[model samples]
Target: MIEHQLIVSILLIVAICLLLMVSHRIKVAYPVMLVLGGIALSFVPGMPRLRIHPDVIFLVFLPPILYEAAAANSWKELWHWRRIIGSFAFIVVFITALVVGYIANTFIPGFSVALGFLIGGIVSPPDAVSAAAIMKFVKVPRRVSAILEGESLFNDASSLIIVKFALIAIGTGQFVWHQAAASFVWMVIGGAGVGVLLSYVIIKLYKWLPMDENIDTMFSIISPYLMYICAETVEASGVLSVVSGGLYFSYRRILIIGFSSRLRAENVWNFLIFLLNGLAFLFIGLDLPEIMAGLKADGVNLWTATAYGLLITGALVIIRMGAAFSAVFVTRFMSKFITVADSRSQGMAGPLVLGWTGMRGVVSLAAALAIPLYIPGTQTPFPERSMMLYITFVVITLTLVFQGLTLPVLLKWVKFPNYDDHLPPEETERIIRIGMAQASLDFLQRNNKCADVKRSALLNSLVTHWNEQLESEGLATLYDDELRKNYHNILNEQRLWLNKLNNENERVDEEIVRHFIHRIDLEEECLLKE
Candidate 1:
C-alpha cells in the first residue's frame, strides 16, 4: 500500500510538471493550472489519496517560500514603499480578518468569532506567485510590481501572527488585547533580530570557511531554515525570521560571496523554489478529498460549506477593495501631516491593481491546515476546523481561478504608464560593462605581473578594447560613429576564426574549443547589448 501511494505521489508530481510546461506555452498562470489540475485529478478512479498533516505544509513549505520572496525583493524599493506596503500587509490584513471573521460568525452556524477570525487571517494575504507569473507577459508598470512584491514579502508575517494569537485565544478561552499587541511587537523585533544575527553568522562562515562552492551552496539553502527554527525555539515569529534572514543575505550577497558561489546558489534556489511551489499547490488540490470527507463526517454537506465559503470569500474581496481605495486618500492626507515620502503619487490605477492582485495560495492552505485538530482543555475537536479548511480552500481556488485569470484584462483596462525614459536593459548593461572592463584593465596593471610577452600582449589588448568601447560610447575619448561598427566587425571576425579553427584543427579538443567559444559568446553578448 505504501509503495502504491509513493508511486501515485510521484505520478502526481510528474503530471503537475507537465501541466506547468503546457501552461507556460499557453500563458496560463502555473499556480492556477496546478489548482485546476489538482481539482480534476481528485475525482479520478483508483487514485491513491495522500493525506497532508497540518504540520507538514507549515514546516516543510512555508519557510523557503517566504525567504525567497523576501530575499529577492529590492531593498531600496521595498523601503521606499514601506508605508504603502505596510498599509496593505499589516493594516489591510488585520481589517480583512476582522471583516471576514465577522461575516463567518454571523452566517455560518456554530462558527465562533475567534474561529472566524482565524479563517479570515488564513486567506488575507495575497500570494505574489500567480500575479508575478502573469506580470511577466502582461507588462504592468515597475511601481505596480514593486508594491505587489513588497506586500507579499511582509504580509505573511502579519497574517500568520494574527492566526497565531487567534489560535491561542481560542485554545485558552482568554483573549487579552494588550498581551496580543505586545506579543506582536516582540515577535516582529525578536524574529528580525534573530534573522539578522543568524544572517551575519552565515555570511561570516562563507568568508571564513574554505568550503567548495557546492558545499557553500548547501549551507546557503540551510541558512533560512536555521533562522526559522532558531526563532521558533525562542517563541519568535518564524515567518519574520525567514523574511529578514533572506533580505539580509540578499543585501550582503555581493560583499560576502564569490561569483561562482552566486551562480550555483542562484541556479539551486531557482530549481528548489520551482519544486517546492509545485508541491505546495499540488498538495492543495490533493488535500481537498480529505477535507471534504471530514466535512461529511461532521454532518455538514458540500452545498452548506460552499455557501459559507462564498460568503467569507466575498467578504475578503470586498473589504480588500475598500481598503485599497481608502489607502490612496489616506496616504495623501497623511503625507501632509507627516514627513514620510508619498508612495501613492502613482494615483488610483495603481491602488486598484494592488487591490485586485490579492489572490491567495499555499500560505492560506498551509495556515488552515496548521490549525490543530483538538482544541486544548477539551476532547472535542477545534471549533469549525473542517469548515474553516473547506472555506479557506474555496477562497484559494476561486481567487486563483477568477481573479488570476482576469488580471491581464484588468491590467489592460488600467493602461498603466510605461517607463520609456529609462535606458534599455541592454544599453544599460553595455554602459556598465564598459566601466567594468576599464576597471579590470586598471586592476591587472596594478596588481598582476605582466612580464611574460604573451601576458603583456593580452593585457594591452584588453586595455585597448576597453578604451575603444569608452570612446565609441562618447564617455571619455571622441565619439566615433564608425568605431562601434569597426569593433563589431572585429568581434565577428574573431568568432568566425575561432569556429573555423575548432572545425579544422585536429589537435583542438572539443571541450577546450567549447569553453573558449562560450567565453567569446559572453563577450559578444555584452558588446551587442547596446
Candidate 2:
C-alpha cells in the first residue's frame, strides 16, 4: 500500500505540474486548474482516496509558502512603504474581523455568533498566492503590490490571534471581550518578541560557524515550521512566529548574508514553497470527500451544505466589498501620513480590490481541522466539528473559484499600473553601481596599481562598458569624464522621452520593450568599438 501510494502521489504531482504549465500558457491561475483536476479525480471509481490530517496539512505546507513569499518580496521596496503595510497587516485585519463578524451575525441567520467570529478570523488575511497570481492579469500600482505582499505576511498573525478568542468560546464555554483583547496584545507581543529574539540568537550562534551555504539553506528551509510550532506550543500564535521570524530574517539576517548564501537560501525555499503550495491545493481537492462524509454523518446533507455555502459566500462577498470601500475612505486619513499612498494613482486600488478578494483557502481549512476532536474539559466532541469542516471547505472552494477567476478583470478595468513607478529600478540600479565603483576604485588605490596606465585604461574602459550597459537597461549610471564629454546628455534625454511615453497613459508591453532595445543596442554597438 505504501509503494502504491507513493507512485500515485508522484504521478498526481507530475500531472498537476504539467497542468500548471499549460495553465500558465493559457493565462489562468494554476490553482484553479489543479483544483478542477482534483475534484474530477475524487469521484473516480476504484481510485485510492487521499485522507490527510489537517494538522499534517499545515505542518507540511505553510512554513515553506510563507518563507517563499517573504524571500521573494524586495525587502528594500517593502521598507519604503512600511507604514502602509503596517496599516493593512495589523490594523486592517482587526477591523476586518469585527466588520466581517458583525455582518455574519446580522445577516447569516442560524449561524452562531461565535462561528461568525470564526468566519471573520478565517477571512481576515488575504491569500498571497491567490492575490498576486491573479494580479498578473491586471495592472496594479507598485506600492499596492508591496503593501499587499506585506499585509498578507503579517495578517496571518493577526487572524490567528483572533482565532484564539473564538476557540475559547467554543472549547471552554466562556468568553470575555476585555480578556480576549488582552490576550491578543500578549499574543502579538509574545510572538513577535520571541521570534525576533530567537532569530537574533540563532544568527549570533550560526555566524560562529563556517559559511556552508547548503547547510544554512537547509536551516532556512525548516526554520518557519520549527519556530511556529515552538511558539504555538508555548501558547503564542504559531503563525505570528512564522511571520515574525521571516521578517526578522528579511530585515537583519538576509541583508547581512552574502549573495551566494542568499541565492542558496532562496533556491531551497522556492522548492519548499512549490511543494507546499502544490500539496495544499491537492489536499484541498482530496479533503472534499472527507468533509462531505463528515457533513452527512452530522445530518447536514450535501444540498443543505451547498445552500449554506452560497448564503455565507454571498454575505462574505458583500461584506468584503463594503470593507474595502471603507478602507479606501480611511486611506484619506492615512493620506495625511503617507502622501504617495494617499494618491489615487498608486496602490490604493490594490487594497480596494484585495479587500474584496479575500479568498479563504489553506489557513481557514487548517484552522477548521485544528479544532479539537474532544473539547477540552468536556466529555463531548467539539460542537459541530464535522459541520464546521464542511462549511470551511465549501467556503474556500467558492472564494478561490469566484474571486480568483474574476479579480484580474476588475483590476484591469480600473486601470492599475502594470509596474509600480515608485519601485524605480533605474534609481536603485544607479545606487548599486555607484557603490561598486567606489569599492573598485578604493581597491585599485590601496593596491597602488593606478600607475599602470594600460591596466588603468582597460579597467576604466571595462567600468565604462558596465555603466553604458546600465544606462541602456534603464538603470542608473555613474557620471564619468568620458561620458560627460561624449554620450551622457543624449542618452539622458532619450530616457526622459521614454519615461514621458510610459506615464502618458500608454498600454501594450511589446512597443515599450522594443523602444528600450533600440536605444540599448545603439549604446552597445558604441561600447564594442570603444
Candidate 3:
C-alpha cells in the first residue's frame, strides 16, 4: 500500500508535467483532459480507496492552494473590481444559498428547509483551483478578469461560513440564525485583526533573531497552517485567517524581511503550492470509485441521478450567466446611490461570454466527500447520500469537460484575447522614478549603513559605473527632478481623462486596452524575433 501510494504520487507529478506540456501545445485546459483520463482509469479494477476526513482535508490542501491563488493576484487587480468581488463574496453567495436551498427543499424531502440551505451553502463559492486553471483559457476583459480572480480569492470565507453553519445544524442538532450571522462577522473581523497583529509580530521577531534565507523559508511553510489551525480552534473560519495572514505577510515582504530571505520564502511556498494543487486534482480523480460505491449501495442508478444533475447544472448555468451578464444591470440600479463602480461599456464582459463558466474541480469533490456521514443520526446515513454524490459528480464532470473544452473555442470566435485595460501610465512612471532614485542613492545609502568611507566610495563608484552601463543599455531613463515633476503632471491629467472617459463611453476604454495589448504583442514579437 505504501509503495502504491508512493508510485501514485510519482506518477501524478510526471503525468501532470507531461500533460502541462501537451496542454500548452494543444491550447486547451488540461483539467478537462485530466478528468477525462481519470474517469477512464477509474473504470479499471483493483484501485485502493483513500479515506479522507474533513478536518484533515482543509489543513492538508486549503492553505497552500489558497495562498498560491491569492499570491498570484496583484493587490492592484484585486482592488480594481472590489465591487464585483463584494457582490459575489457577500451578496451572490447569500442569494445562491436561498435559491438553491429553496430548490433542494422542493425536490428532496425529509430534508429540512434549513438543511437544504446548508446544501446550498456547500455549493455556493466558485472553486479557486478551477477558476485559476480555467481563467487562463478564457479571454475575459480586464475588469471582468479582476472580478473573477478577486471573488475566487476571497469567497472561500463566505462558502466556509455556510458550511460551518450547516455542519453545526446537522452534527450538533443546533441551528441559530443570529449566532450564525454573528459567527460570519466575527470570522472576518477576527481573522483580519489577528492576521495584522501576527504579521507585525513576526516582523518584530525577525529583527531580534538571526534572520536568514532558510529561516524565512521555514516560516513560510509553517505560518499559513498555523494561522488556519488556530482560527479553527476558536470556531473562526480558518480559510479567512490563512488568506489574511498570507496576504499580510506577502504585502510586507520588503519591509519585514531581507531580500535574500524574501526570495527563499517565495520559492519554497511556490513549490509547496504546486504539490498541494497536484495532490488536490489527483485525489479528485482517484475518488470517483467512492462516489460510485455510494451510488450503487443506495440502489440509485447514474442515469436517473444524472437526469436531475443535468437540470440542476442548467440552474447553476442560468443563475451564474444571469448574474454575470446582468452585472451591469444590477450595478446600474445600485450605481445611483453608490456613486462609483467598474463598468464594461457595451455592458458586456466580452467575447460573447454570455454563459456561466462553471469549472468544478476538487473543492466540489471535497465538499461532497465531507458530506455528513450521520445526519443528526439515529445512525441512519443521510438519505439519498449516494444520489447526491452522483449528482455532484455529474455536475463536476459536465462542467470540467464541456465548459473547459469549449471556452477556448469561444475565445477564438470572439477574438477574446484581452489586451484591453492598459496599466496606469502614471503608476508605471512613479515606479520607474522610485527605482531610478534608489539607483542614484545606492552608494550613499550603503555608506550611511556601514559607516566606512573608503568602502562607501568604492561602492558609490561601482554604483555610478553600473548606472552608466544601464543608461547605455537604455534601461535607466534619468532620475532628474524636473523630469519627475512633468511626469507627475501628465499622470494627473491621464487620471482625470480616464475618469471622464469611463463616465461617458465605457467601450472606448476597450480601445485603450487593445492599444496597449497590441503594443505588448509588438514588443514580445520583437523580443522573440531578436
Clashes of each: 0, 2, 2
Which pairs clash in the backbone of model 1? none
lDDT computed for candidate 3 = 0.62
**Higher-TM-score candidate of 1 and 3:** 1
How do all models score by TM-score? 0.85, 0.80, 0.79
All candidates: CA RMSD (Å): 9.8, 8.0, 8.2
lDDT of 3 at 144: 55
TM-score, candidate 2, is: 0.80
lDDT of 2 by residue, 1-530 (tens): 79998998898888678868877898887676666677777888876777777678667777667766765555555666676677767777777677767766786555577767776776666677777777777666665666678778887777777777887887766788788877787787777777777777767757777767787887777777777787877777777777777777765552345445555565666676677777677677767887787778878777866776676667667766676566666767777776644446344555567666677667777777777778778888666667667767777788888888887767766655454343255554444344434444444455564554243444456446544543323333433454432333333334333433333422322133334524443453354345
lDDT of candidate 1 over 315-382, digit per residue (tens):
77788788888987887888888866553466578778888887899888888888888987778788
TM-score comparison, 1 vs 2, better candidate: 1
For model 1, what is the alpha-carbon lDDT of residue 464?
68
Q: Which stretches of candidate 3 lie over 4 Å from their true place?
A: 108-112, 137-140, 171-174, 343-346, 350-355, 415-530
Best by lDDT: 1
**Candidate 1 regions with alpha-carbon error over 4 angstroms:** 339-345, 418-427, 441-454, 470-530
Query: Each model's C-alpha lDDT?
Result: 0.76, 0.65, 0.62
